[model samples]
Target chain A: MAAVDHDRAAQVGAQPLDVKAIRSDFPILDVEVNGRRLVYLDSASSSQKPRQVLDAMTRYYETTHANVHRGVYAIAEEATRQFEEARAKLARLVNARSAREIVFTKNVTEAINLVAHSWGRRNLTAGDAVLLTEMEHHANLVPWLMLAEERGIELRYIRLTADGQLDLSDLDRLVDGVKLVGVTCMSNVLGTINPVAELAEAAHSAGALFLADAAQYVPHLATDIQQLGCDFLGFTGHKMLGPTGIGCLWAREDLLEEMPPFLGGGEMISDVRLDGFLPADVPWKFEAGTPPIAEAIGLGAAVDYLTGLGMDAVRRHEVELTSYALCKLAADHPDLVIYGPADPASRGGVISLALGDIHAHDLSQVLDTAGVCVRAGHHCAKPLMRHLGVTATARASFYVYNDESDVDALSEALAEARKFFG
Target chain B: MPGLEDLYREIILDHYRNPRNRGELECPPAHRYEGFNPLCGDEIVLYLDVRDEKVVDLKIAGQGCSISQSSASMMSSAVKGKTLDEARALLRAFKAMMSIHEARLDAEDRELGANGQGADGEEAPPMGDLEALQGVVKFPVRIKCATLAWNTLAQGLDGANGSAGPS
Candidate 1:
């Protein structure tokens, strides 16, 4: 597999990286949950920050706690440098051509909102459609919905195959009248990784702009915006073992220039007057207020931590862990109904399931009692729940810190929940 | 202290496995109200037939955890045949009991608390076998599960009375 992308592997991972040593870098994994050793399997929701990321954030707040690009003072200069350096680091992680393409925002939700308001509202009109899939997170779904309603644009949905793959057969039909396509690179609930490159090609062939929500995929695998061939991409820092308050929107430099500014505020402007004020270019036009400074620095450090471990290795580790978990779950707990594909390679590390005679919430509670923390809900993907023919499901997601032992613990706890409830 | 075994008592499991009033209500004099607990994805629809200001009949149907479904079954029996105001009182008493362990409703104020807010938005818990759900308050995540049925009941009354918006 490494030979398949030998050039990429040569640039990124010629030297073998020790993931166990990298796991040691994250101190939060050493804590206890309800008297049980912490097995943090909820990285799909939000990852645990490593020691370096935490220390970087704390060090910034302690020493360089000043406003960025202001005051003409040494402290402000240092803060601005730290902030821009973080942008540069994010650019490297996403394989962006320039740091100017990275617009710091609150989270992936805010980043998507910027595009919906600035790009979609202005370019889209009545009869124009925005093609999306059934697999999108609500954050990606609702903004387009609001924009479509406001702009009188049609919202078209691409369906999903029974095997949980994207129903790309009708992509051409769905994008016939579409102006833009907003899709998820990976479904958080189903854990299916969509082929972003091919989807972007389809979307472009239909003459539509594409925005890929990289929230779930960016955390586990390496991302190259250029290779993905999407005009815009959005992701949150929290899900990638960074601090919570920061995220990025990576748009093609030309596309950012073409779209108008989303919000108006102090820093986004080159100059302001009562008459005809002009907004700053590219990333600055989108970033409207005081950007999350220390958090961005932490995200930069988190990217450093991930890069040090090598994302391919991390991807391989999660594949092995989730595959082992799925087999153990089906083999031991015959009553458990694990949703999505049986093959680990077909999905990411997320495992959604239901215990016999027990609702997902009850299953979650039983797991929690044994200190096996997992998510129990519709996961903000209610449409997917309906598609799966169930009310809700319990999900356990794995990351670099996760191993076979953690899956073993979840397996034991799940059997216990079923027996106690059954 | 006895682990999940303490939470999933035999009676609770029995009620979950074979729920009472488990199907959707037929369209008849009954008005329906659906309540959702977004956190746990538990949902319940309470159907009510009100006549002469009394609950002539009641049934609940939904998919949820044992705490939610069992609590709904208990509510159907407790609120049936009770006056609308009396049913309201039961809900207030039950909610209070679940939220505050030691809260005891006074005979006279129970009706007042149910019809309107108590002090500081702290109305008494709804009354009935719903009180068995008091154990859910100990688990913050399950609190929504236990309240799914009661909230739906409040909504059904709101639809009947036309002021059920807040519930």
Candidate 2:
């Protein structure tokens, strides 16, 4: 896969990403930890929210705080509009044909579970397979595994290559009896950005529905459901600089309409006559009970913020920083084993490193004292860790707010950790 | 003080670099159990040999962070050649040091003097080299890493009391 060349894209129509100005938008970046300036490098776990997103949620709570659909009052109607408008904004962000196709859930985990339990249980039968890559997070893998166990279907895995990319050499055989092709758009560990459109095409040609776990991809890159041609794209709001407890599952409207409600409760039903209940419309049918109203509004604002900054600029900044980090880290620590593509062009800003004889937790702890926040674990992808022949790696993921200085802090902290551990 | 230097004490690092009694014990008269932190994928497989209600031999084998591996190493040395009851007491003392359940530090304060010193009071027993892990208390998250081997050994002792398979 070729590097995206997002720098060119940013230069074309978008203003150059001003990281210093962007840093000001996130207040938490100013915090101090262990008497050291905070250098947050854990965006893959969750991105920090900007004041725009925070203010939007607070404003919604302060002014318009009422339940939707059932209440016919003025505030209720206002709340309903804001909530639906949030859906429209999210739909627009992903280029979904209709807002009705977007289903709000707790997080990407729930979104994937919604599709697996609601659509999967109904459509898939015994002997059918859900093809997944080895690099899938537990959020994408466990839900499908549960479905496979209950429905008596096969769960096949696509092998990973030596360089940490998905080895699609046996695509024909792997997709033979597979009903669903579930894969991550980008590896949280390896930082390998996958060819989502190409994979979706392969799934379609093999008569399987493609579900791309865009939890990692949607935050760092520009997402277009139409361009990707995926049947379903699951992403969390928190990873995109919005609050937790909100995520979007964008599926084809017809598919959502055909699928039954995942959870049976209020707002999801149109008429309940003691014996049987009629489900609500497409997206609402999936979102049962009290929805994450404020969270959705906040997510809408987050989408707006990203749009204002331009995703191409965000990507360009990340690519430049990642390239610099790769070079800087390589030059500084010759013994350090950084995973994923050596070329920052081939990967996102996530850099997973294994220093010689130094445990990731130790590195993380040492770095923590230096006020460098990094993820030091299997990153919810144990199989991928095993594939990489490592117990864990200290992961540093970049976002819109992260700058070159943050990477320098991480590097310096890593050096300190190495020396201290030795 | 709750410092990184205190947490990664020289004694802890020594044990981590050269873990004591790290290998598999023969199956006969040996009870093996595995412990996993799961959060960081730190695993410890404890092999215990009990004879006449005493742990005559013990070995720890697995891969993990320095804290876990060092704790396991220290645990093997701390418990080896001790009666099951004595080992349990040491385990209790270690857990108390970690203040597992957020228990009052009064008891730990009495045991560990102001600056990683030994007990001044008679009621609190000095935890010795285990006192090096007193710094681990500041890092609540790494407490699990420091306790994996001891917990696994505890489970293995229970298995010995119940099944004692192939003995």
Candidate 3:
């Protein structure tokens, strides 16, 4: 599969993504679904892992499997070193100030929950507001909602514009008295890339902390905590070609030190007496139990993979593919109603669409027969779905391995679906 | 490996295209029940008018995929003037056709099982147009969509019967 166009790469001025080589790395991309080649477009839900990531985990378990942090044995110390190395890799990936700023979590959901439970409960009280956005995934929204329920705090949202971008017109009013403002760096469904740095500036000017939900952004874009100017950021491993059960929460060290521990268990406490226990230092205090050690190692490998193929190159490839898809879908299927920003430069690689009178589930079902995997339904953003005036949208999200051929296949399948339904 | 044709049979597509008993009935005499397939966000809103053990009329209003909407349409047409007992029998027959009971069977037994039997140990009533949805059983994720309307009807019937004093 000579998928990358070298001629076009020259025009872009960035090193072209060797999509053929990248696809070879992911074993599942070669799999056939329904006697057709699999076209995985559901990376936003969870990305397919590369052999490197899988091999890294397998190698860890086979050679250096042991409980981390507590054990003084040889393998255990090696395991601890590897785990901390993974943390350092993640810290470097996002350009955090120190490795101590990175806290390992089950996934992005657990990371946000940690903040809501530990930092939120301590800082927030009744009548205090936490501002969020309309396009937030439930992972970012639910934790704050739960906090609101428990502490009687108010929740406000930065509304979405007609074009699907965050409507910052009301930011001044919305962020007025809020203790913290949380927003997704990119929308999972709409593919809207938000202006995190600007929002972070607004949040700070209003004397509020800002948290960026980078579950979608970190994998597709070049990210920097300093550039984003966020107080806290959360992202998952699975969406970045890493194994599941591992995520990261990178918070400013000072803020982390001030907050109490989220989950009270081993590996998080300095000393446990019958009366009470003293919590450990910043990062470890938030990591409660024997962590997902091998998963962290795999995530480290994923970071290494992404870094080797520069993030800038990956972003350029996605933008180009997204532009092609948008044009192809529009030209071929005029009835197709696409959701999100019209410009490919303004969004990530996710494309959510609705065809005339066809429900998203039915569309997805038809796409499945052609071996194109897409996500259907509310996408766990029912509030955003309601805002879009739709029950659901079929979303096809691209990743590093996807190319123009996949988009062509998607268009062909969509045409088949329309004819079949008619 | 059932083909798309099996799941989207002509009869099912017909009902989906021209749904029967769509829209709401006035509520003073009608009982409303809603069913939701939270997995896919498919909603079924059913309005039932029951009088003297008979379902006089019913209407359905909701949004979903072909399986759900067509199933709801067929259900409305099938049970418009039937007795509550007859409607329940049809519901049981349709669910059996969908292999609802087989889902609960232990894995080993399920592999060897024939068609699911109704609770009464009697033969299931003939499932007329509802048989078109039999293909849904192969697509397990869509079973909820095919049964959403029937389940809502059951709820409406139960609520109507329960609200009316002992007959």
A6-39 per-residue lDDT for model 2 (tens digits): 4356546565688889999999988989888889
Better of 1 and 2 by DockQ: 2
Rank by TM-score, highest first: 3, 2, 1
Q: Comparing 1 and 3 by TM-score, which wins?
A: 3
Residue runs of model 3 more than 4 Å from their true location after superposition: A1-13, B100-117
Clashing residue pairs found in predicted model 3: none
lDDT of 3 by residue, A221-319 (tens): 878898789999999999999999999999999999999999889999999999989999989999888999999999999999999998878888888
Q: Which candidate tops DockQ?
A: 3
Q: How many clashing pairs per prediction, in order?
A: 15, 0, 0
Order of candidate numbers by lDDT, starting with the best: 3, 2, 1
- Which candidate model has the greater DockQ, 2 or 3? 3
DockQ of 3: 0.78
Better of 1 and 3 by lDDT: 3
CAPRI-wise, candidate 1 is: medium
Cα displacement (Å) at residue A349, model 2: 1.1
